[model samples]
Target chain A: MIREFSLNDLVFLLEALRWTVLLALVAAVGGGLLGLLVAILRTLAFRPANWLALSYINLVQGTPLLGQLFVFFFGLPLLGVNVDAWVAASISLSIYASAFLGEIWRGSLQSVSSRQWEAGASLGLTYMQRLTHVILPQAIRISIAPTVGFLVQLVKNTSLAALIGFVELTRASQIITAATFAPLTVYGIAAVLYFVVCFSLSQLSQRLERKYHAPR
Target chain B: MPLVDLADVHKSFGAVPVLKGISLTLEKGEIVAVIGRSGSGKSTMLRCINGLELVQSGRIVVDGIELTAPGADLNALRARAGMVFQSYNLFPHLSVERNVMLALKLVRKMSTEDARSLAHAMVAKVGLADKLSAFPDELSGGQQQRVAIARSLAMQPTLMLFDEITSALDPELVGEVLRVLESVAEEGMTMMLVTHEMNFARNVADRVIFMHEGRIHEDGPARETLSAPRTDELKSFLSAVLH
Candidate 1:
């Protein structure tokens, strides 16, 4: 006997959305801050810092997100530092976001023409001054569309957090499907919910892309 | 001591040698023009003096500071030596006012009011006061180059290096930029320039240097050099451009 999805199921999934939004925010704020550091280290002329940032980006991008999730959620327990699914998901997602965004930002930062650096340097501006006055301003303009695009990916990626028993949108949908035997109704709604969030963000990125490209 | 003295300077880009044992000197307030065909190391010599390019061997002294020394203060050196490029490398993101005001506020640490006023004065000097709020893209190639000149002049540098500053301008636009350079010259600014405008050199430069195959083939008073051809290399060079 299969039960139709009651309002309770819809309500529960709506509640899980808070976790989804919270996780994405945590990743964005944490990842954004650390990602700036990673981007700087990778782009700077200093060798050792560049190597360290390169390794960080490789380590994150080379392996599966699931592997990193377990390393934080499951593997960390063996070391006797207990962490909940929320903490582990936040940590894993933040690290994941940092590596990806750092590479994106590094590309933007490097995209500022070498001639721009020479112009700034020729004017007797120090490296830091050159970056703030000229390079970073141009780089930030180049970075906006991609950075916002990554945020949309990040929102969708939060669904993977449910695998670790975090009870986000996917997990909540799974629980409803199991109990009601209405995978069609429950999953359809879940899909709509995810689409709504991701689509809104994707549209925002496109709008911003157009806005940035529009002439002054 | 000369304001700038380069002694047997040699420079390379990876495997290709550009400036090979080049030597030159500029006294205070001398307006000298360097001329040569492409790949003759004229521009590289200017860059080395500004510390924009490093030499593999030999020495470059700008304003009594040896740029060859490892820890030489580049900013302090650059502060005294302003350079204008053929490409007019103005900060595209900044307005004309901000572009001229950048080094003043950041490097020299001038107050906002002081920087703004000085920037206005420099822009007016270049006859671009009406376009002070304009972006680089909003202006013509000639106007942009004038802004570049004003940006450099705002620092009140003791010496200015022009790397074919008029080469990128349209044929009609060339005169406007050259006129700005003329006023700058009239102000008694010490300047070293690489230019293809033979007439500009004839009219404005006190001295002329003709570089050939990484060496200065001919150098003398601008009046005499433009009129008489001592070397076949220079004679051919002038013949190629003059027509």
Candidate 2:
């Protein structure tokens, strides 16, 4: 039975938005930690580890995120591995973020010159020591902008959580519109919520870029 | 045995042979200059001395360690062998003092206070006492090269390899760096350099080695080699570089 749209419906959408925000936060922290390891491995030039990290990035980035979500959500249950939608969505989204963040950070690491490596080597610092004391500090400085930009993308990509039945903003809004037959009004507000979150993050990345990019 | 002994060390980059069976020995406190045209493998030889490049054959022993042998302690060998490059590859992101102190802290495990004091002293020795807090990009090319030298010197290496360190400097700036080299030589620091400055080689180097086609064509006392060349390659090289 069709029901009339009311203020309660908007409140429900806002409540669902909390999950979206939390998912993005989890993805950011989790993806950042894992991606840094991946990025470092990619730059280290160790034959096996480097090749494995590259293949991992390629496999994740080459396929659709939706396909990744299905593997965790729908496909796992058929093999008797029961994963709830919340866990499945989190896992897939984090892996997606890791792939992109790893690639972005790898670029930053490589931007540090070959001369830096030679200088560090001449100083007799071990490869790990050089990375920790010399290379990474510089890479982290150059990486901040693109890293923050990826976080903004992470925030928007969480709308896909709806597919796994996570009941985030998009899913909640869709639920409300089906009952009230108010698709435009319900979805427009959902769109606005995404815009607000994404716009602020882009602004944050820009501010970071300006702060670090001083003219020499 | 000499402090550094390369017994016919051969190196190639993929299919291209760069250093063709080169052997040399360096005694403590000796300043030897290796002069040659570009692609004569002078820089590659300098790199091999410090294990920057691996050899395809033959042997290299530095500071009692066989670098070409498996299980050689290259990092420990490199600890005592310092090198300065032609491009003056200073750590652009770090301050002059930080650049100098990086190895002391990381490799030597020196405390910050000790590293700081020693780095400041090295910087002063290089005549960059005023540029301690400045980034490399803020310094002139010559000053940056000196900072690179200071960075290597802070490690207190027993031997130094300078691969045309002053070649990238301006004509006016070249004097300050050469002066630093002269002082280092006088202080009895063992050094091997590849340079184009004939007068500096004649005056400062105890010996001169003229390389052609990846082999040493002439090796003798600097004055004798500069004044009286034995090979046609040396005569032509001296005339071309001088003129």
Candidate that would win on lDDT:
1
- CAPRI quality level assigned to candidate 2 from its DockQ score: medium
lDDT of 1 by residue, A29-88 (tens): 999999989998997889999999999999998998888998999999999999999999
Prediction 1 global C-alpha lDDT = 0.91
Q: Model 1's DockQ?
A: 0.70
For model 1, what is the error of residue B180's alpha carbon versus the real structure, in angstroms, after optimal superposition? 1.1
What candidate 2 gets wrong by more than 4 Å, as runs, is: A1-7, A40-51, A179-185, A206-216
lDDT of each: 0.91, 0.89
Fnat of each prediction, in sequence: 0.79, 0.79
Give per-residue CA lDDT, model 1, range B1-243, as digits (tens).
999998999999999998888888899999999999999999999999999988899999999999999999988899889999999999988899999999999888999999999999999999999999999999999999999999999999999999999988899999999999999999999999999999999999999999998888898999899899799999999999997
- Best-performing candidate as measured by TM-score: 1
TM-score of each: 0.94, 0.92
Model 2 B-chain TM: 0.98
